[model samples]
Target: MTNEQLQIRVEQISHDFFKKPFIHKAYFNNRLRTTGGRYVLKTHNIEFNPKHYEMYGLDELDGIIKHELCHYHLHIGGRGYKHADADFKNLLRTVGGSRYCRSVKPEPVRTPARYMMLCQNCGMKYMRKRRMDTSKYVCGRCKGPLKLYKMEEANGTQG
Candidate 1:
């Protein structure tokens, strides 16, 4: 749906469920890859991942919206709005919001490593399962200093 449509939906849901008005913007954010939705503390705006709605449909989207709305309303009402807080949990449960913003299934892990750290002086490369500390270690070849030259996580795998 369009951003305007989403705004309307969020406002409608807020009034219907929480008996509060959602006075901020609500829209799809393509850059939101992992999170289903997020409520910005600064702007009180809500951003939803369009991919979530495309993949999981309306029910899942609604749950995500409700989850964000819980944060929005609680924060505005001057209550404990963090996920770990009792007030947040209670309101979320009452409204049937998702406990966590659902994560999209990440891309597959490659065989050996998802990132590669390279030496600046010797051009020696080290493939790593996780992010390597460049400051701590040096290259095996020539004992040269290392730098994070190539990050392969974005291309073929999700790290």
Candidate 2:
């Protein structure tokens, strides 16, 4: 949904559930990788991850909105808005908000070899996580001087 829709929804939810008006902005933030939603303390704005809605659907988005609203309302009223606080806990339970921010499946991690060393005489290549001292460590195959080069991808792209 658009930022305009998000603002309307947040305002409506605040009024309907919290019995208070939400004056600040609410928008979808695609850059939010982990959390389903976030309540900004400085801006008093609520940012929802649009991917969360696409993945989990409307029900989950509603719960996330409720959760962020708990923080928004409490913080505005000078109440303890932290997750550990009793006020926050009570409000969350009352509004049926999610206890924790929902997390998304993370992208697969890749550990590529950062450094590569080549033997001058034998042309034997070596991969390493860290830069090596080529002068001290000669090629085992040909006992030749090694030339170091950086590798961007572990798939064997030359640097």
Candidate 1 vs. true structure, TM-score: 0.67
Cα RMSD for predicted model 2: 7.1
lDDT of 1 by residue, 25-126 (tens): 999999987789988999999999998888888889899999999999999999999999999999999999888655687779767676787778977768
TM per candidate comes to: 0.67, 0.66
Which regions of candidate 2 are displaced past 4 Å? 106-159
Error of 1 at 122 (Å): 37
Q: What does candidate 2 score on TM?
A: 0.66
Number of clashing pairs per prediction, in order: 0, 0
The residue-level lDDT of candidate 1 at 88 comes to: 95
Per-residue CA lDDT of candidate 2, range 73-149, in tens? 99999999998999999999999988865568867797878888988899899988898888899999989999888
Best-performing candidate as measured by TM-score:
1
Best by lDDT: 2
In candidate 2, list every pair of residues with a backbone clash: none
